[model samples]
Target: MQRQSIPALTMALGSTIVLALLGGCTSVTPPAEPVDVVISGGTVYDGSGGEPYLGDVAMRGDRIVYVGPQRDLAARRTIDARGMIVAPGFIDPHTHAEVFLNSPDPEQRVNAAWLAQGVSTVMIGVDGGGSPDIAQAADRLETGGIGTNAVPFVGFGAVRSRVMGEEDRTPSGAELAAMKELVAQAMCDGGRGFSTGLFYAPQSFAETGEVIEIAREAAIRGGIYDTHQRDESSYSIGLLASVAEVIRIGRETGMPVHIAHIKALGVDVQGQAPAVIAMVEKARAQGIEVTADQYPWLASGTSLEASLLPPWALDGGNDALRLRLAQPDERARMKADMAENLRRRGGASAMLLTSPDLAWTGKTLAQMADLQGGNAVDTALAIIARSLEHGGGQTNVASFNMAHSDVDLFMRQPWVVTASDGSNGHPRMYATYPEKYDAYVLDRRTIDLGNFIRQSTGKVADIYGIEERGYLKSGYFADVLVFDPGGYAPRADYLNPRELATGVTALFVNGALAVENSNPTGTTAGRVLLRPAPANCQVRPR
Candidate 1:
């Protein structure tokens, strides 16, 4: 039988007595501490490559102060994150966002698309392209008010061009000394590392010995070596040899090495993921810290010239290449070389032209050829010539050169981190993280949620030695994200490359709200991250 409820006074007195007995005469427990922001009632993934747990996260100023069940914690602002996943904000280890960041337009400066994907930091000056004057570049980016935090890399190409021009020859003793000085100065000026697009001209002309010597400067100053290795296809040295070159650089320099956009690019190199992985594994076993990054898509974005022109053709520079193309004999030789290059790239049908100057921004090379009533090679040549004449620098192409199996294989490796390598005219620029999250983690189930987050967040931060970020832990920077796990996905695609993604509910960069309820707050709270001294670099023996 149900007993009548005790009187209000008796009930209150009984609870007080119970609490006192439980505490054994100790003072009453204090109320939870106050915080600046509290994200309550959510599943938390701490970015440690472990299972998520239900908990609360509290932040004050720019750092996380509490991460657990904090029912009594008081915050000036509370975000009810019920049924959502709360995790550390994603970090893009490789990106070209600096171009957009430097734009005078406020909308462009906000970097809203990437912010919506929960990216709080981007490592820029990648693929060997940033000002050699690191301090000046950092100052400009800082003054511009970017939305995502930025870290600068000193470009090997930029330095090489500065000292040697576009000529393809070994540097003289004085020139080599000058280049080394530039690298050291840039590192001192807050560059995170040395970045080289050795796959492209000028840098490609540099022998492996030269790269190792230049990278040594960064290594001594506490910087990693990040590279678009000399070749990813059967281009000159082949992908396997390029991987070995990267390992040699790391070994000689005594610094960590990172391969940008690691992949089995092109049909010639497809299905070689195992070989590539083995090389990297051997390097790691020898105590050299080696890692790589990849985007989710099968297609890789590059300028039309980069896709088809042999490194030798670009020896003198753009002007020289154009001059050569004008000569009938040189044009004939270039056409033959381009035919083989196109075949290695999986044929013209697989290459989609995304250049704005041409009328065929979304058409495949085959389609463009058909439209122009010409063969694929001739059509490609015509497009390049037109782009040079009146279009622009170089028309963009999305080369569908990767194998799905190879992409999956590389992605499963623990050392492989996620990166956008994102730039304008490609959907990857807007949708990289979400595509990986949705396609691989949710739909394909190739990777679990915790591992996916780890690859994109903590792993990247750890690899780059970014300070006080990439984890939801006490005393860490409060760059955080809250999103609907089931609904979070990318909306951008090839046809509509600029469409912003959907499903992020809230995002915070340095404790400032950048996005709320899937809408932008128009806040630019990003900071310029400097290279932490190499003492923190992870160097472990196998």
Candidate 2:
């Protein structure tokens, strides 16, 4: 200024005075020691496919600074982890936590149901139901304080619904453009990837070319494409062709493809697991980025409408579909198609109502039919008609459509990672991790403890490109779990679906204790994970 401005002069004087006081204070006081939290005397698995070893892990602030013998180290908190298995917290690759958040109970908020099982992170918005406002949802969860961290994948169904309702037709040029714009906006807003459910309404109408074009947009942004493929049971298009489509998209667009709930449903598809595995192996051999996730259970859960109705019958939303159901001519066509679909799904006797009328819970379609003195087909149609009348409410049903041999073969594959496919009606939400450990590792002895943990943690993290997490490494984010391996078990069953699992003792997120002594601290220390972000985005072992 012409003369130094008064405020600028005051700032200069203040800076000089502040610097002098800081110097005096620094000289007068000794430097404070580093803040470290230590976990002592435990078997460390580390999640790197390494042999387990006994050691102590030390954390400074939110990062792990040391992982070795702790005789000479000092810390503010020293946790005794004797007789416990210390590993990276489990990451559930597929979940429906977004729906649970719609409820108002704080205890039920963000699915603390998974926390006690040592799951610190969950991938939500799967099966074509993730939100476009992913960043805003993450902010809300963080502000509300969730018990576990969550990452969202933008759903094609939600995007399509926004662009064109549930109409059963191809998207026009303008509609397609609007869809692409919405996807781009979601990705820019921190969505990890794009997901689609081809078996569901609206999305079912999309041709392969449409899916490929949209997938390319996500690929450009370094996102993955996950799908509930069009068919998993029959050799019509077959599992091979379905998997091939996913691989082709990845190869063409340079994006990774993940197959959700990899399985061959129905007796005809039994023993076909090896062929599917070989196909995935060959794709990976050719340098296509491909992977898959599976829930341990043989039975799968979905809505009664999804599992039974022909795709065309569900083309429009509830109102239009109900109108079609009301016409006798339309009703006969739908009933015939429903009969064939039910048979293709292994019959109504194999289908159990997961979330029906309170009076019908645990009853099979066959049982309901018998009680009403009508055939199973009629009973099933009546249930769907009632649900449509209620404005398209969701009803859960379990399909006993998978084969045991197929389940074992998939579980043994080195590349097959574990996911819950967890949701409201499915017991996987409450029991996936522990159930896998108990069934595949303990009961079947198909995989060892080390291999199982690797599949659940490190392998999943690698597939999704999650950094620093899924391993116990120095200078990584301090997301850790301590559990009694011998004491671990799952308590929930289909009949008692809401019970919690047992044996995880402590869980830490970002150096803060989120779960202590099998109890949640009710703190939401989770962060939103965006694509192309560095590995330092998560808490890992030091």
Candidate 3:
């Protein structure tokens, strides 16, 4: 113990030399020779926004090995895709399927609803409600065997709750460190990025600095930042400012940013679509990577409590809010504030209750209130009180808070991609893609079909950095959809929301038929996409 002395610089240099040598020799071995699955005689869009062409695609195991004339391909299985448009399976960039998977219903777990809509892959844990155990969840689903590939985001709310409990406050120094470590662990566990609903409780308490710090970790780890920004409604620190915050995060932290469910909500921000678009474009011009998703409808959905009550009333948790609602004077003030919130959102008539009791499912708030023999605000309060009493906090409600014209304006932007913000909300789960195709492509002709396909596929894949997906190249994932363009349309409406969309004939997930002849084959062939670190960042193929 006393005899040997090591030279500090010499040892350090020796270790560095050893690491450099190891790094220089590191290489990825090519996958073993793949099993071929051939798809023949199809009109392929390829998801690249390139023109549709007649060709055949050959798949080797889970990846596409060939996409050419299909003249000389031999395979164990051949799908006759003649007269169908074979393109990359749609990627839903924003979804809440993680919550559904936690449900007791088996149907909810697999999310066959999305599968029927030609969605082969989904990004789950959006809007501040995801989990750190996303890999375990994916494994559970894979082990249990479900349809569709799912990638998850580490949620801001979940991380905040873990670090700060249910209280609304800024993180203490140690808590901030804990939150950062949780985020890093989540990324290391296979999360694609971080998602925040800054408008929601717990997360709403987070200051911009805290968000930037956590997002910077994600960026360094090669993850994107997706946000449901602080506000989407009023011009006062709303749409423009919120969009600016996303851009600021991207610039400051060097993370690519995606604005979740980007919209100009409420009448105040109605005609401000162009201004918002200009803000995004300006940020892009300054070399900030920013993009957004829209749901193809004017109305948006959220918890009734969050939508109606002022942010202050929601400061603490459900218990504090219930106490305030019990006091007569506080109740009166809360009602007044809620009325103002309703007015800001358009009107009571504009609000539709998507989930109350099963009986109230399809009713508008005004109608439900009328049935309850009181004003809409009182009825909403009653529902909230009853839900609290029954241990059912925060019923889901849809506010007709968007301008159809504004939606059209946003959809026309080249950088704007399509998403459902998919959740229990009817349109998101049922009609998101087909509705966009029907509305923008077929009905109004605002955007051509090619652009629609591009927005749904390659554009989203490019934005989120999904590998070998969202395209039909010679060597890509064989996640493909075959649909009749003329027949494609969303069949679900607000009243009957759970209806499966029609017109997609077949879907292939990892070269295995997932949806066959308008039916789900119930195959779970999706792989968890663990993106490389920033130092080895792969530019997602265009």
User: Which pairs clash (backbone N, Cα, C closer than 3 Å) in model 2?
Assistant: 64-542, 145-524, 146-524, 474-542, 477-539, 477-540
Instruction: List model 3 lDDT by residue over 1-542, tens digit each.
Output: 11112233123223432333233221223224544666777766667775565667777877787775545555777778775667889999987766555556655656677877898888888888777665576567676655678878999999888778767677789999988888887776667999999988888788898999988778888889999998898623777888888889999999889998889899878889899899999999999888898889877988888888777777767888888999999999999988988888888788888873466788888898889899989988988888888785578877888877888888999888888887675566778998887777666767776777888899999998898899987578889898866566787887777788887888888888888766777666665565554543333221
Off by over 4 Å in 3: 1-36, 103-107, 533-542
lDDT of 2 by residue, 1-542 (tens): 12234344224323432332232211112113545677877767778776665677777877777665434456888889876778888888888866655446666774677887788888988877887777677677776666677878999999999989999998999998888877776777777899988768888788888888887767777788988887787624767787777788788888899989999987667788888999899989999888888999978988888877777777778878888888999889988988877887888888988883466688888899999999987888888877776776877888888887888888888777889888777788888998988787766767777787888888989988887888877777888888876666788888777777887878888777877876777766766666653332331211
Q: What is the C-alpha RMSD of each candidate to the true structure, in Å?
A: 9.1, 14.4, 14.5
Preferred candidate (TM-score higher): 1 or 2: 1
lDDT, residue 447, candidate 1: 70
Q: Give the Å shift of residue 84 in candidate 2.
A: 1.3
Which candidate, 1 or 3, has the higher lDDT?
1
lDDT string, candidate 1, 463-491, tens digits:
99998899988889999999876667788
Ranking by lDDT: 1, 3, 2
Model 1: residues with Cα > 4 Å off, grouped in runs: 1-33, 533-542
Candidate 3 lands at a TM-score of 0.89
Q: After superposition, which runs of candidate 2 have C-alpha atoms over 4 Å from their true positions?
A: 1-36, 70-72, 532-542
